[model samples]
Target: MTIDESALGFGSGARAVWASDPEKSRGRLHAEETSRTRSEFQRDRDRIIHTTAFRRLKHKTQVFVAHEGDHFRTRLTHTIEVAQIARALARALRIDEDLAEGVALVHDFGHTPFGHTGEDALDELLKDHGGFDHNAQSLRVVTQLERRYAAFDGLNLTWESLEGLVKHNGPLTDESGNGLDGPVPQPILDYCARQDLHIATFASLEAQVAAIADDIAYNTHDIDDGLRSGLLQLEMLEEVPFLCELLREVKDRYPELEQSRMIHEIMRRQITLMVEDVIAVAQAKLAHLKPRNADDIRSAGQAFARFSPDLQDADRSIKSFLYANLYRHPDVMRVREQAAGIVRDLFDAYVRDPSLMGGHWRTGVSGFDEAQICRRVADYLAGMTDNYAVKQHRTLFDRTPDLR
Candidate 1:
């Protein structure tokens, strides 16, 4: 159904009219019947949960490598955290919660085994080609890589799910199809050609919430993980004014509390403060924009679920601190270097002999040109778990780092 974008007061009720409505979704590429018990977005969430890619997240890296510690956040755990925050934001805005949750759950499907380090190596290696992009890879996974159903190659998700997945981070291009920030990835462009996800437009409010939720999850958890890894000290958190404030408040409230409990109190409060901030901002924006429907949100050319200027400053400060103290620490960089080498070595090996790849990956090589072959190899490699990549590298090469 075509929505009247010129209309107003759609959000007059307790919730937002700008929220994505699964019942009024744009529908899937491969049409299917409405579920008896679940909304379209709910079905999308279920499909994501059962994907092999989702299962692989358990062994994928977040900040630390998977083998570093048992308690550190893996991709799986991070996705769960993001989903929870997304749901909370969605519910507060009176949007469809399931779409937000589904977007959150599948957002990281494209990440490589060793995290951004692995992605960097692949992108460098594939530079002559279209280059490796986790976001594009995520779109590829949901639209093509998955092969569970008898009729379709991918999950054939509702159009709304696919749209949110691609545009969760905001508009990729302008109305002219020119890149808004940088060149749009080839896979995304190609997919949009077949079924336009309106790459130039901002995504639904539910997706906007999921995007910010990602930031909230990583910022807080990375600090938590950094402390546990000894790369970050509680004292070092003082560098970020937001964390410093939270720490000061907690300390003042419970001067004699144990270290662990004090940290927990800080983390929980951080989540609460951030979540509440976004909800308040979103409510006001919805009040101002008065979106007639979800499509009006896409046309608004910005996100509804935005943090205030102060929170945005805090967000950057936290990221900068993480980069300097945790992600870029000498010990972490050493591990990252080793991880990059593994990805590069495996890419070279596979490009030379496709047989090195397993199953359907090997068989598909003959139909594509050299560039296509490299991407296929990258796809297979990108799908590997950290341990699997290490093992495969050892099997093919004379040496491999223990990555401890």
Candidate 2:
């Protein structure tokens, strides 16, 4: 059965507002007839939940190494927090909550083991083979890497969701030019188009919300972790003029705030402030336009724009502080170096000889070549927890016997 243009989500007006072509239908699933019916956004959410990438987040690092503390936030927990914040903002703004949730859940699904440290190592190692980027890798994973389904090669996510994964940076840069710092050139535009497979331009408003929420979650949570790790003092935040002022304002409003409660309250306040700013900016742009028809409602300038400059600058400051105070501390760097060595060594061993790989990897002989071997080795290293990677490293280099 063919879907009429009118019956679909986008109408004539939507087509005009969109910078690119509207998303095309990818054929309906036969199982939808018998299984409980879900909205398109809900299906996106469910698909992310069941994917191996999503599950692997459980073992991936958030800030500290995965084995540092059992209760510390893993990549999975961070994703959940970002999703919760994104869903709250989406519902408040009448956006598709499920779509926001889905984007938030899988945003970091491509993160390598040992968190950003491992990602950096992979980038250095694979510079010749198209430098490894988590965002680009994310698109590759959902589009081609995953092998769960017999019918499709990937999770077969919706175009909107995939776009969210790639274009989450908002109006930062076109991939060639440094974001906000460099002039937009033709070369930059061309590079942006080719940077990632799914995104050729800026993200939608909903995707931008997810991106901002990720910033909010990490900024607040990382500070919390730093305090817990005894690396950062709440008082030291006062050294930074803007952060000091913000903290002072927050404390003045809520005098009963404790260290434990302060993080949650500060995050809540920042999110509300940012959401209101986003809505105001969006509405200001659409204020002059009059809706011609039903299509006009969806076509308004609601999908453009990004978090205000003030917010972006503030977020950058927070990220810098976290990197200096926590992420790059000697304690953290030591573990990161150790993890990177493990990944590098493992990649070297497997890529040199695929026969060393056990289980399902051994069965495929002619089909398994160098590129395939690299991916399999990457898969093994990427799936490891911090302790597991260390143990594997010991087994390979220290002549420790493999119990498994």
Candidate 3:
């Protein structure tokens, strides 16, 4: 039952010096016997896939509601894509592929049912209660909330996994403890009280790859989804020079290709080009940094895995266009408005009548104060799938806003 050593980032399949060696892992909060069959990172990845949280992703929104269309990417599909791209980047950069894949898979665990719309609503509702950050919540899920182990309430993931979950994009605070991106989330700081993740430094290279893979994934897929939903078109895509060039190439190469195939072709090529750009940028940076070990990567201060300057500019252009065209489109915004209302209404309903949350969630709510109750409610609401949220809203209110 032993995994091929090569597959676990060892032997001939082993990566460069800076990869996070599972043998060197900082280990889990709740100590358990190591698996004889799997690398710690691989164990983390498998554990994530088996979690109730991961399974819920099947019905969670990525860009479109699950009921909007069958083929549009759900959170689960997007996560798989992110993991694929992340592994590619890790393989190319000679880092731990399993760790990268695991981070990518778990990155969106904290997102609410209706994508950003649900998150925005929840954040507002909990603002006085220390607010909510998906990154912090992600760490919370793995370290404090999964409740699978008898000895631990959470999954009790390794420190490296938890660190990547919390600080994949960058450090949460500065060297002087000032928040780098406004106030750091309370959940993260509270966790740090027991396990100092050194929030002032960069996460490992595996984490950085997962972070950029997210950028690469959503940028390409959202456009594809936007087109599928009729919220975006080829004509509008021409406004993005990067996309325009890619589209022009596709047209010139296969003028007679059908719309679906043409879009898929464009997406694959876009992913290839963006992934290559990241590899090149990271290699050049790594050459200069010459990190001897994983620790050196953290203290290096600046990000190593990055898009080149040109690619970064193109990334911004794509994001801006999506913001204007797809995200802000009147129809989409209307749906988002309704989605936000659902989240807000549900939070209030749960707070007013904790019994409405029934099951184990209800029995646990008795001793909580206002903030604690709100947080528990937020967690319950956040974990709901789009269909469940809609059902709950229908059960609570005589009328629900039609997302369509």
Candidate 4:
């Protein structure tokens, strides 16, 4: 018997009315002839995949440090998973898959070496100098760093891609053009001054899916990793009712299944349930909002793609559980302290003598002020992989943590 496409979450094969169209794109920052063979968003995805920052993700932290274990997910693997989910959701919603996937792939480019630990250390060290934000650093990476093309410094992605990357969570500003949560990062604000990304408006549907896909990917995988590392046990998951239910279902289906296979079964089912929930919720919102075009999605002032109210609670529950059991666990906290020390030591060493940074990073730093020097050092430091940061710390400081 044939199955209905709609039942499978393939909502009417035709493109949705509000889907982002490549031909109607907002174009790139630095103008160049469009590729004959690829859509604008495809080019954006391809360029991101080829960047040095993208390659560095392989050695960057996700939850566990990169060297923790080969089986654990790294930033690169997490990005790939996010991209896969984003693409699947985009296809189901009949939106722009390339744009969604591009956004997902590039979202974590700005993250420092040791996941949030490194970012926190850097932020505290530079608290006086606008602080460190991975999102802003991501924008800086694509727009100013990378230095690939002859005419342009960055990959020069399309405005849609850039907008999605910067506003992955949502609009950075409110109706009066004031930052909502706090001051918008200086790097993002500076870039918008040159090319208005309409930070006040919600991003396109493609971006919305990418952002939520990030939530889905990390929420599920971190638990998988935590379980693998023995930081989290199957019994601990009972704290969250949703996970408890999934665990019960898994056990019922395969009463004698081994722990590893049982965990994988639960993870795959969890992803499916979450993805379907997002698609259904988004589809319902789209029906109500009746957006006429991609711009309508941005100007709607609300995120269309998201988990339902119940699932939102579930999502929060999972995060709370992870934070308590895994992220803030004594063992993890110990490593975090060591990781933060490395970042702090490196920052001090670089700030004291820019020459310690070496090469072009040291070239013009002698003429710069304290803030300028710190920002430059941050740029160099943020680009490092987990191994590289540890190595650098070992070189400069008398002692270094093994990060085991």
Best by TM-score: 4
The collision pairs in model 2 are none
State TM-scores per candidate.
Answer: 0.96, 0.77, 0.96, 0.97
TM-score of candidate 1 to 2 decimals: 0.96
Instruction: For candidate 3, write residues 153-220 as lDDT tens digits.
Output: 88888899889888899998999999988999999999999999999999999999999999999999
Q: In lDDT terms, which candidate is top?
A: 4
Backbone clash count for every predicted candidate, in the order shown: 0, 0, 0, 0
lDDT of 4 at 323: 92
Task: Tell me how many residue pairs clash in candidate 3.
Answer: 0
Global CA lDDT of candidate 2, please? 0.64
lDDT per residue (tens digit) for residues 300-331 in model 4: 87899888888999999999999999999999
Cα lDDT tens digits, model 2, 68-170, are: 6676788989999999878765554445667778889989977887788777887677655545667766766776667787787767776667767766764
lDDT at 151 for candidate 3? Answer: 89
Better of 1 and 4 by lDDT: 4
**Candidate 1 per-residue C-alpha lDDT over 317-382 given as tens digits, one digit per residue, 9 for 90 to 100:** 999999999999999999999999999999999999999899899995687899989998999999
List the lowest-lDDT window of 10 residues for candidate 2: 1-10
Error of 4 at 69 (Å): 0.9
Please, what is the whole-model Cα lDDT of each candidate in the order they appear? Answer: 0.89, 0.64, 0.90, 0.92
